[model samples]
Target chain A: MDMRVRLTLAYDGTGYNGWQIQKDGLTIQGELEKALSRICSASIRVHGSGRTDAGVHALGQVAHFDPPPKFLNVPWNRALNAVLPPGIRVLDFARTDRKFHARFSARAKQYSYTLWTQGAFFYPQRRNFVWNTGPLDLEAMQEATTCLTGSHDFNCFMNKGTEITDTIRTVRNILLAPGFTPQETVVWIQADGFLKQMARNIVSALVQVGRKKLSQAELKSIIQGRDRALAPATAPARGLCLEHVTY
Target chain B: MDMRVRLTLAYDGTGYNGWQIQKDGLTIQGELEKALSRICSASIRVHGSGRTDAGVHALGQVAHFDPPPKFLNVPWNRALNAVLPPGIRVLDFARTDRKFHARFSARAKQYSYTLWTQGAFFYPQRRNFVWNTGPLDLEAMQEATTCLTGSHDFNCFMNKGTEITDTIRTVRNILLAPGFTPQETVVWIQADGFLKQMARNIVSALVQVGRKKLSQAELKSIIQGRDRALAPATAPARGLCLEHVTY
Candidate 1:
């Protein structure tokens, strides 16, 4: 009988090229594969809940793997964490029915893009994890996000080179939290799925709207237009995080 | 006429040893000295409000520099920030009275220590900044902070190697914020001054107190004892931040 394992992980994406396997450089998947390979005594390919862009971090990223026959008794959760690098950690692991897939069976995903409105040097500590955007109008950004709620064709917010067949998705929630000091503004979005540069693009547009360069109607029109050229540029990937994945 | 320049700086302590000018290795002061030497056309020394340990960071670190007559008209802030490396940035500059000293004139210093209690590998994104532990009880920790209040002999919390005649200091506040997701905790402390490793030592003691290993009376005894052997070990330096200094 085949065994499937579900593992929830958290990683700092600064050192890796995101969650997938890459031919040229380091990746979260590459590291996990190496660790799993050592534990299972054979090669293992792990499927992630989604593809996170380079520099995008994760707090609750889910992945699954089918253990080879020889590795039946390994206590995977503890074993993998022991050999993994200090930047990536496995939070939880459990043996699941063979049918469970980290990628295909996911129902909805949540992401958060963090921006700091004050402090010049981008926090010397948190520089890689948050986008530093001097000071922004939070009320304006909150009003602007209302336009992005519900299902819509988000082609305008997709990355230029994305190879996806569909850009339609439903956004379940859009939460805006503006900080009082250290000056921060956070946008949390939950959806069934996201397009290639969807979060970044949405952030870009929302940022412009926050700056009062674009109005809420302008955002609605950009999505209605379904043209990638109509949206603002993608926000930097460093500030975005894959918050959670539900399967 | 003597000129005292007030400077607000931000630095990544990972590469440099700390803020002070030391013979050991790269330091934030050494970097600023070199930058100022180039911009002012003469060598200068910068004095910081406090000395942060190696691998520590700062957001609102204040420093002062007194330059010779020749560079009086130079646009120091903008020119210096332009030449400084990516990791260090100068936020602003102002000319202070000749008697203003960065260290002696500081009225109070606030420090924030970030604790991630989720055993997850700190994301490379935040690796240099936060201290990761796993699942801590915040209310218990807060309840224990009461022991650290008022003026006490802090020799127990001071590092063993530091030689200081006076161990009495006043802790104005010890604020505990519960973790964001049951896996994070933040402790912010404000004091007139801190001895070497004082903040880390308090955290170490508090962690034990949080875990119910030590009673509040024991904590009081540790402070009242004035013996370094009575306190818990020092927490790691990475989790502590030199938040602000009141002049």
Candidate 2:
């Protein structure tokens, strides 16, 4: 008998190419499948809640897979963790109904972007995890985020190469809050779904506003324009993290 | 004219061999010297407060050097940080009198060791900076520390191969405290100076007491014995950090 297992995972994305399987580079999915296949002595595939780009970390990413009955006796969470590298961890595991699908059953997601506004230097430990942008006008950035909240056609905020027909996304909230230090700022966004590069693109536009390069009214016009060329470049992948996926 | 300068630095030890220059691989000293040489347009050498072993990090490791007077016009903290790799940073810099020496003038030093008691998994971000020891008896470890504090000959804890004639050192305090997370514990030790591997070796013995392999009485006996064979093995270098140096 085959049983469905749901796994909640966390990872530092410094070493992996991305969440998807790629022929030329290492990926989170590829390493996971390899470990599962070795444990069960059969080919295994895992479906992730969504794909995260290279260098994008995750605090709570959901995935699911079917395992043979023979492997059911093993403590999967511990066994899988023992085999996985230190950069990735299986935070929790449980048996689930066959109807559960990681990608299809997800209803919403939350992402957070960290910006280090400290001038000159950054802590060595966090150099790879946060965007070091010297300094920013937080008040201007916060005001600009208000223009991005609620339902809108996010075509201008997505990667132009994506072939998806639907560009509409419902942004539940956009929050800009102070982090642990005076120079640190965290931007958290919750949404029903995100198109390719949507979150990063939005962050880029807000950063422009913080730098006083674009006004809040111009931000609204950029969204209304519905043109990807009108928006600023996407923010670096290191600052963005998939914080949670709601089922 | 040569003017002595003091530098307060921080670095993640994941990439370098250690604080000292090494023939086989990259070291923190080598990188810092290279950057200084480039800025001064001449060969440069730096004297650190002490040499940390391989894979040991630093939060406020101090150093000093005299640069050519012409080079003093450049902003060192900003100039060196711009040229150095992301893993190392010059946190502070200032011109000091000729009598100021990073090593000889230091009055005390503080070292911290982090142990993660979380079962089954380690956070990816801290995987290299902490010891994932699962669980430890805090009370036993605290009791064991009392025996190791105060002025004493730490021959049993120092690395056996070192040729330093005097093993006498004064330990001002040893603190066992909770870390940021419930499952994490931190051990902070302050002393006039440390012998090679002394901090790690003491931590190893305390861990042995936490596991009930040694009693507080035996730990005291180990110090009295003044024999390296009487102590437990040294802890891994990853968990140790040179936190600060006072001058």
Candidate 3:
């Protein structure tokens, strides 16, 4: 019996190269594939819902794979995790049909970036997780988000490397709220899909707007300009996390 | 002219061999002194409030040092942090009187330990910060605290090998509260002073009582027994943190 299995994973990406296998360094995909192949005694390709950049964490990244015959009755969540490193965890596992794909079946994706804005000093506790941007103007940032929501051509907010022909994306929602503490600001955005570095660049543009460097009019123009150079530099990957994948 | 300086520090202790400097391994104290020495161009000795074992973290580990002449006018906090590794940070600095001591002048200390007790999967984000002791009985743990609080001889909870013979200490406060998430149990404890590994052992005993391995009466007997061997093993040091030191 060839059963397709889906695994919801959460990883601390601070130490890994990225979600893909690379020749130069360790990666989340490399680690996952290594454990999967070893456990089932067969080659495996772990297909993630989407690739996350280096230092970008994930709370609910979805992936699907077909295991070898030996793994038909195995307790996958426990067996796979037993061989994985402490930085990655298999949070959930279940059988799925071959027609269901981790990437194609996903309806939406939610990403969050944390900014530590109140203190002058960046505490070591949040070093690899949050961006230390002192005193961002939240009210201004919120107002600028109004120009960002809904359907728009997002070429301005994407990295130029990938050949993404269709640059438009529907940004369904965006919210800036007080994080776990008053000192932190959590920027949350949901979209049908994200372009390469799209979330980071959008966040960077908003941060510039919060700093009053880019006015609301300038932000609108940047979106309409359709130029990546017109937007602020993309934010650091350490601050970005894929929070959910809705089906 | 020599100036006495006091510093408040925060560190992620996941990688080092504890707070005190050792002959073989990297430690928080070793990193701090190295940065201090390089910045001031002198061999500086930093005296901390106490020594924390390997894998133990600290949010407000207090220390004081007498700087050489070249460091008299240096902005100690920013200067020391510039050269320190990302794991350690100097949160604050102030000039103190010659009589003020980091260890002897401290009146109280507080420590907090986090335990993950709800889910079968231990999430990677909190791997080094919380103990994964799934599904502890909080009500029973609450009932067990009564026998453990207040002034008592804590020899059973203290790890042997340290020369200090006086095992009596006052546990002024201990509270079990809902953590950031419903799955977590934050154990907050304060004491006038602590014996070596006293906090870790006390928490271990409470956890044992919660699991029904030790009854409340058994916990009381264990403390009264004055035998380190009678108590449960000291909890892992990674979950324990020096939260505050009051002077």
| lDDT tens per residue, model 2, B1-247 | 5588899998988868999999888899999999998888888889999999889998889999999877766677899999999889999899987799999999999999988877765677677788888778889999888898899999999886678989999999999987644667889999999998999999889888888889999999999999988899999898888989989
With a 3 Å backbone cut-off (N, CA, C), the pairs that clash in candidate 3 are B117-B135
Interface RMSD over true interface Cα atoms for each candidate: 4.1, 2.6, 2.0
- Candidate 3 docking category? medium
**lDDT for each residue of candidate 1 in B64-138, tens digit (9 for 90 to 100):** 999887667766768887888867877778887789999899999988887876654444445666677666666
Off by over 4 Å in 3: none
Shares of reference contacts reproduced by the candidates, in order, are: 0.49, 0.67, 0.64
Whole-model Cα lDDT of every candidate shown, in order: 0.82, 0.88, 0.88
Which candidate's TM-score is highest? Answer: 3
Q: Give the TM-score of candidate 1.
A: 0.90
Candidate 2 has an lDDT of: 0.88
Query: What TM value does the first chain of each candidate achieve?
Result: 0.95, 0.96, 0.97
The DockQ figures for the candidates are 0.43, 0.55, 0.64
Q: Candidate 1: misplaced stretches above 4 Å?
A: A119-122, A179-182, B23-25, B68-70, B73-77, B117-127, B133-146, B178-182
Model 1, first chain, TM-score of 0.95
